[model samples]
Target: MSTTIEYVRFESTDPTELAAHRDGLVSLLRERYGADFLGAHLARSEDGSFLDFLLWTSPEAAARAAREMPGDPGAAGFFGLIGEVHDMRHAEVLHSTQV
Candidate 1:
């Protein structure tokens, strides 16, 4: 099985706005990324920055999702207002006891 993980960092002048935009972004991802394989997390960092973890079922699925990300759709600068970096990693499952 393939596994992918991303650590995303987002910061914005307005945390509430960022949270709202993030909700929209997640919705878009859920629609395009396929079923039974998409997951995400959002947390407030010690520095008050937002940390996001997005997990997918496979590396290929992650890449495909990346390529298929929805267009701005008038949501310009959404991420810039909330996040800066999206750190990502891809790997294969060598072993696993739980899903």
Candidate 2:
């Protein structure tokens, strides 16, 4: 199966707090999703908005996380810090290279 990438663009007033919460969220995902959760990256744009990239083993895994994450108690703190979600999307990984 091809990998899937989940992208989320959002704003957060307290980036520091959001970063801290992100650690816990990542840990929770790793524990829950195991190998299906490939990894994630959080980036801050020049305009101050944030972008999150989550890599999953398949589209099904990404969709399942999207459906369940909001209701997961461990994710509450992470979600609470988001001021607004500008966009969210998922796409199949066409190509990837790692050294």
Which candidate number maximizes TM-score?
2
The residue-by-residue lDDT of candidate 2 on 1-92, one tens digit each, is 87999999999999999999999999999999999999999999999999999999999999999999978999999998988899999999
lDDT (Cα atoms) of all candidates against the true structure: 0.66, 0.96
TM-scores of the models, in the order given: 0.67, 0.97
Instruction: For residues 1-99, write the lDDT of model 1, one tens digit per residue.
Output: 566765566666677776778777787777766573567787888887777777788777876755555345634445557545545445555664646
lDDT of 1: 0.66
In lDDT terms, which candidate is top? 2
**Which lDDT value does model 2 have at 87?**
97
Candidate 1, backbone clash total: 2
Runs in model 2 lying further than 4 Å from the true structure: none
- Error at 38, model 2, angstroms: 0.3
